[model samples]
Target: MWGGDRLDNYVEQLRKERGLNQEEFAKAIRVSRQTVSAIENGKYNPSLDLAFIISDFFGKTIEEIFIYKGGADK
Candidate 1:
């Protein structure tokens, strides 16, 4: 059951843990709040550059934020 949580759920968890509202997090990541909402709702997969920016902002690796459900080998 690894990497099973929905993207929205994971983002919500991270937002709460980091004490960031959508507007604040979006500002930090230089995206619109609606964009953050879309990402949190699993409606979008950010570009690699944006992904890296987000991971760096949170001090986490991309793998930590975006899970690969089928395992590393896919």
Candidate 2:
């Protein structure tokens, strides 16, 4: 669990920046569109494996995409 850490991600932004819709981005990461929607809406925190996949697809680190706030940031 992330404890008090809030899951903040820039997936939607990055996806649009790459000209990908949710379905396209989801396909790129091999997940369902619902999963991408959930992550973008902050309703789900991706597992480490999915996180790495997303990060790699965007050529970014997990910290760059999903920002874990409220722990050391506080």
Candidate 3:
């Protein structure tokens, strides 16, 4: 479920840090701008493949970008 409210990401921050807009970042990651927007807004959970792609594009690990805040529930 991508944790809904429990999921957090640094996509927007990283994209801005790299001076790339949503469209540019989406293109770099081979995804639609809307998809990027969804991920940035925390309304969508990326597939494992997409996660790898994004992480690779930013030279980071999936855990570095997507954080699960529901760990406290366990």
Q: For all the candidates, what are their Cα RMSDs to the real structure?
A: 5.2, 3.1, 2.1
1-74 in candidate 1: lDDT tens per residue?
Answer: 22223432266578879999999999988899998887777777677798798888878888888765543434
Tens-place lDDT per residue, model 3, 1-74, is 64378779999999999999999999888889999999999999898899899999999999999998875545
What is the TM-score of candidate 3? 0.88
Better of 1 and 2 by TM-score: 2
Candidate achieving the largest lDDT: 3
lDDT of 3 at 37: 95
Q: Give the clash count for model 2.
A: 0
Candidate 2 C-alpha lDDT tens digits along 1-74: 43223779999999999999999999888999998998888888899999999999999999999887655552
Give candidate 2 misplaced runs (Cα > 4 Å).
1-5, 71-74
Relative to the true structure, candidate 1 reaches a TM of: 0.77
Model 3 whole-model lDDT (C-alpha atoms): 0.90
Query: What TM-score would each prediction reach against the true structure?
Result: 0.77, 0.87, 0.88
Worst 10 residues of 1 by lDDT: 1-10
Residue 69, candidate 2: alpha-carbon lDDT: 69
List the candidate numbers ranked by lDDT, top first: 3, 2, 1
